[model samples]
Target: MFYSFIFILFFFNQVKTKSIVSINREANKIIKYVNNIPNNTWKAGFNFKSKQLKEIENIMGVLPINEKYTQSLEDLGFAIHHNSNNILDKDFNEIEVLPENFDASKQWSKCKSILSVKNQSNCGSCWALSTASVFSDRICIATNGSIDNNLSGEYLLSCCTGSCGRGCNGGHPEKAWKFIINNGICTGGDYGSNEGCQPYSIAPSAVELSFENTADTPECYHTCTNPHYTTPLQNDLYFASKVYTVKPKMKPIMYEIYKNGPVVAAMKTYEDFFHYKSGIYQYKTGSSKGDHAIKLIGWGEENGMLYWLAVNTWGTLWGMDGIFKIKRGSNECGIESRISGGLPKL
Candidate 1:
């Protein structure tokens, strides 16, 4: 009986050791698979271990690539008509001065108004996240860093309605700006934190398999009442006075970012974006995924490659510390197609 007990313990230990070895082997394969992409412009490494590799592509914080959504750009939620008053036509030569190079991260770092990078988790709410980020940055710039407040993407996700499109599933940045202009949004932090009017409902690391078929859009609410806890009244809400779209071109878009601070821009994303690590990202070859809205903060040149420095909603673990550089000048990935934002009303 004593020998049998010892054997049982030994057997369990061996089984556990074997399971660990198997997991390590699988992780090595995933890393090799990423490195093997032919002529890959960017590097890819493991953000998750082997056991989670099957879901690795989904865990990168991007919605799955869908051909149907890619075929129709309008379905991505960019408004067709923008307010003409806010349009900065080419005739306005005074505002068209493009510097040799520019980088907002460096320019605004001293003021502490540079927008903080955020994560969207499994929710397909990049539209709201991008808009809120730009809004937060603009408020800081407009106030000369005096009122640099972290605006709430959660308020936009759960409250912004009408033409803003459905929350989580997908939405438009311009429509979100309109919502903020019409109905103010309160301060909110990430999920699981009640620091604001309404924290993000979706928890981080909740991977969604597909945006089109599986993800459910959260219902919109007008108040900041969380079902789980009693919260104090939130009076830290802000609004925008004007929201407008920019023409999809290099000069105008650059001018907007240079003059007005960061603006939300929607661009085509691909399967390879999930594996991006470091390098100037020009779309190589991959299935064209749906559009993603990002905050276009600045631009610079690297080894003769002119790139746009955009802040992604994914956390700092992905890309160059939560930021990415895409080939500029040529409007790579249709990035220049849809750019829009507005001024903060103090």
Candidate 2:
């Protein structure tokens, strides 16, 4: 009996030692990766330290790089509902003097309407989340803080079918706005709440940062059928009418956010972006793999570096509390290229 027990203990110890060695090796690799990123102003470290090093690396590897724009916008699901002739003739022509500085989160403190940071999980729903976030904030601002409610990204992802693209595959912000203007969206909280028509199906906390990718895009459900929830009243439903693109310039983009609320921006993201922690992020290296949509809420200068304050949908744990600073003005990563938003009809 003593020999049998000794043999079992020895076997377990061997396994434990191997595991420790493997972990140490992965930790070293991550450290090396952080060190090797050229001219990175931001710091990169394990945000999810509780996870095994290998698991974290796997998570970093599998996180869906937004590759939705590779095909034509129509093929990617952006269907145009309105007439094309008068599309560019909309009210986005308003010109305003540029401010030296502005921060929406600080200005709207009483409303507390500026949304808390959100996570998109493993899905390619940044397009929907970014649009819904901007829509939610704009509705609150336009209504003088009375209509502050979190709109549903899941609704846009699933229901905004023709132009807004598919749930996990990818989507476009402009198409999402068009859907909001026409159909209207209900108020749904994050993953768990039954407050709105359709709450986000994926739980941010339950996401696995491993090699096996299990999250799948859900089907579009037009009606509010969640037994625990009901459709919001017509007055409670939010919609917009004047959707326009901000000219890809510093002054114009700044003016739109200052006058309205937040705007959705499409940015070219590289491998380096996945490791962002803090500091003004500029595309340092790595191949331009995909495009990501985010809400551009405000802009500021940090230590002489001007940066745009972007709220990401990767939850509060991913970037700097789910917020990232991109180098502004220079249009780094094509951020200024696709700045778009609309006035919320109060």
Winning candidate number (TM-score) = 2
Model 2, 1-346: lDDT tens digits are 9999999999999986787677565545654676677765566655443233333322221122244542343353433222212323243355444555678877675445475676676667778888888888888887778877788888887787556666666767777777887888877768876756677887784433532353576777666645676544454467776676666777667767887778888887765576678778887655555778888989988778888988877777767888888889899998887877877776
Location of the lowest summed lDDT over 10 successive residues in candidate 2: 56-65
Q: Write the per-residue lDDT of candidate 1 for residues 1-346, one digit (tens) a residue.
A: 9999999999999986786577566555544665676765566655433333333333222233234533333454434434334554645576545786887766776434354777786667888888887888888887777776667787787676445666776776767877888777776666676646666776665332322232345666666645543544345668887777777777777777887788888887765565578877876554655778888889888877788888888777778888888888898887887788888888
Model 2, CA-based lDDT: 0.69
Report the error of model 1 at residue 29, Å. 10
The collision pairs in model 1 are: none
Q: Which window of 10 residues has the lowest lDDT sum in candidate 1? A: 56-65
Which ranges of candidate 2 are over 4 A from the true structure?
Answer: 1-40, 48-97, 205-207, 211-214, 225-236
Q: Score each candidate by Cα lDDT.
A: 0.69, 0.69
Off by over 4 Å in 1: 1-41, 47-96, 110-115, 206-221, 225-234
